[model samples]
Target: MASATNTKIVSSPLLVLLLFSLYTSSAEETGTTLTSSTEEKNVFVLDNYGARGDGEHDDTQALAKAWNAACSSSRPASSLLVPKGNTYLLKPVTLSGPCKSSITFNVKGTLLAPPSRSDWTQDTIRHWIMFQGVSDLTVTGGGTVDGNGEIWWKNSCKTNEALPCTEAPTALTFHQCDNLKVDNLRILNSQQIHLSVEDCANVRVSRLSITAPGTSPNTDGIHVTRSTDVQVRDCAIKTGDDCLSIEDGTRNLHVTKVVCGPGHGISIGSLGDDDSRAEVSGVTIDSVQLYGTTNGARIKTWQGGSGYAKDIVFQNIVMDNVQNPIIIDQSYCDSAKPCEDQESSAVEISNIVFKNIRGTTASKDAIKLSCSQNAPCSDIALENIELKLEGGDGDPESTCQNAKWRKSGNVVPSPCKGSN
Candidate 1:
């Protein structure tokens, strides 16, 4: 959900595929300019006339009008634009794209969501703004998409709830989508996931501030599932739970240049329980910063589940005031004791590597590995991981056990042998 942008690299893998028609300005990209003076561009301005965020107000109609007007014949090329203005209160809105036409939401104003769940109707039970089957889509600009999450995060309805807390209240959700780019936006505060891109391929998220308070329940920054070829880079995150989480059916993912705090840093999965029908593989994370977080980098799996995680790497990370910098918890659940005992792990963690991570810790141990006794984590390598904990005597009780851990002794990542 976040990233930082340096000068664009000259030739990337997808340059040929990039039409270059979207941004027509020549090389010299200077300071911020309001309008892109190129052809085939659409523009829409949101003023206080119709769009207003008056507490319990619903500005859904105004937003829809703007979207419809932007997509109308004036911008027939489907160049959806966003003009600058103050935050316009709005209900959940859907921004979808067709296969042939690429859409750009040049965020100009903050899109504030409603404060009350009862303000929304039941039929509208999806993300705050759901994007589905979008192709070659780009969401960029210097504005924010504030979910107004304080009220809803603590009340999200789970499957086992008596009365549903709220339904489909994510900040932004994409399902079964392809070729999306989310850049330079502040996507924060959500009932559930801040931004979710599921079942999509070839997606990139950069230069964003995706966050929620650490006490907020289920306020994950970015949750990707059943997806491939995804990259999240160059952003700061402060959230309730996992800053970045990759679930099942995910492969070939990369994360870099991130700053995290007050949350679980980067996580693989609590994979299992038939919740998802896939596995995660071929992931790499580098140049990250973790602060005041629950766990720095983690790979979690259910106690009794199925699947396999392979070919992952974590490199060049900075830790500050974090509890557990490196962790792999194959036994994951909210309950105190293990519930169901399956034959083997529905998901097996293997072939992973951690490289060049340095930082300080506030907890007793720096790293903890807790894989299943039956299906152990294997073929793992941790090289050049330096850690320091200020108050500890270094030799603490066992908090890590199952997985294989090996690394340079500068800052030892403790094994998962002890309980909290």
Candidate 2:
């Protein structure tokens, strides 16, 4: 489970009635029914509420006020317009709702974050902008959200250990939301992760461009946890960490038509951390392009952790100069301190399929399955895979330890000899 953040939930019955009256009056005057004109007159403009989009003033309060007005409006649907051609400077804020109606947050301008690390304190929430408990929400606009994360990136332990390590804020976070649609947004240079969807269901994300420097610490492009029926398509992501990460409790996730590079490739797990239970199932990745990544496709779990990962598929992938093109490491450890050698991981992995994967690997060991001895990986299948080292003379090799798999049709470098 992820850490909880403070949310400010507000509603006003009198305000709702007033807005409803105003909406109805406007619709009647315009000779349109309330059903057809609900979205037209229900726009709450931030500029009218004293939001000067000059990129210098803090507009957090102004945005919050606009959110409250829209959320409390009694219309069937309301729009919160962030108009184009201006830059709105903002601080950490949460827009929470068990709203009376659905909302559309139309972002058409730039939202800029503080430039200096000293501007943010540790007690601040780990998110710059958070949407919580909202259903039927659509956040779509051709705009940019700039985190200005250079200072935070410099202070990170991944860059320099002389500075004290602290948590940086995610650029955008959606928590406990359902029926969400996010499209055509550019999220760039976040202090931590770019976009996070946690405990959300029935989500569709597309046409998003998420980018950060390859050396940035912990800057995953999209991280989903405890979510279901999530579909991410037509996204171009370049980040330091995994382009897409599926954490525990996520199911029925489909990712397709993605272009990823200069990052750690798509991954599942590094789960079972601190002896915790982690489970993820029913994930599919198809038609992805990975270039110059640390790892192409991977599943990693730590020792002394219990749970199961099953029914996963990776097909129709194209890798270009990637390291560890295909891998599963049961003894996955990311900390600087050495981990104690354990006999096995308690997590069970089964029913994984990798098919039609064509790639060029930078490492000689292009395919590696290092599973736990006690709980070996079972029911794994590989088909039509062709991986070769980029500039090496020798053929790429497959390394397997306590992994059982079946192969069919055109496998390159051949399967390991000790398969059961």
Candidate 3:
């Protein structure tokens, strides 16, 4: 997929190889470890810290004590292990650190959240398990994190109109943690967002399986905001909201080799909301497969805001029966009340590239770019795109408004004006 060129397309195998080399080079240069290892790490077992390991008993105190000891240890590399073959119930807890050294929080057993909001006695229950201010941390083990969120879902206003809307707790959060690695974990049935990384740098999340029911409300698989130099690779996500949501103040984010379905596809923003400035740049999402999703490769922003979202690329993507396979909605409004028509200003969107995208769309509108009049989108390039209606008589259609774009190769139902 060459920009501004009519050259023949490269084969898939060669493209994948080149991408792999680039990823590896970046990994090496940044010193981001892709895997978690327990060897050479001093072990601190939870059972030794007075935890009963019973499903009904509260293990929050024991976990706190264990974390304190681990953080205070003089060892260079420490490990906090929750042994396998048991289920431990945890209340809302925050594990903060400016720890002694590098640490690995290994979860080999099932960590179950409180079943309902009534079980939470904290002042506020916005986050179930939060790790804050830690550096050089790795959380991995082939275990399960069960949010037990059915009761919350049933009471959510999004699910039932009778209930007033309220906030639900995210399952896991990493705030201000640098050099973090999270891999080989199963996160299931979260109340809201499954995992969030906020205000962090140099993070790598890979080989994770995150899932929730298709009808569950607001269960985004991974949400990254105010972070930089992050890489997400080799994950499978099925949730109600975006599989990967990249938010404001994020730069140098790369996502590759992900499988997403039964959810909103990979998205950048819903940014610049409430008349605020938002900045996001240098994002590359490549080699992803989406099936039965609401939207694929989307960039959305609210009106009446400032700043810019630019230098993004979505390449080598395949979609199966997806709706809105490629879209840029600059006037996004998720409120229950209708937004006023035609705002004056918006987030400036520029330098977007979509390449090697072949898909079957469930909706008739395969590509929709609805940009703002005041701050129109610019430098949008579409290359080697071929999208068809999944089960219809005619080819899928496209609509473009207030976007300056160009097409190089094989775009079906071309969206740009004067596109051949």
Tens digit of per-residue lDDT, candidate 3, span 97-216: 999989888887789997769866546467999999999999987677999889889999999988998888899999999999997778999989999999999999987778899999
Which model scores highest in lDDT? 3
lDDT of 2 at 179: 96
- What's the alpha carbon RMSD for model 2? 11.2
Candidate 3 global CA lDDT score: 0.86
lDDT of 2: 0.84
- Overall lDDT per candidate, in order of appearance: 0.69, 0.84, 0.86
Residue 48 error, candidate 1, Å: 12
Specify the poorest-scoring 10-residue window by lDDT in model 2: 1-10
For model 2, what is the alpha-carbon lDDT of residue 202? 98
The candidate with the higher lDDT, 1 or 3, is 3
Using lDDT as the measure, name the better of candidate 2 and candidate 3. Answer: 3
Best by TM-score: 3
**What is the per-residue lDDT of model 1 for residues 102-213, given as tens digits with 9 covering 90 to 100?**
5666775577887878766777755788877667677777667888877775565433355465454778888877888888777878777889989899999877777787
Pairs of colliding residues, candidate 3: none
Which regions of candidate 1 are displaced past 4 Å? 1-41, 46-57, 69-77, 154-168, 274-277, 335-338, 392-400, 405-420
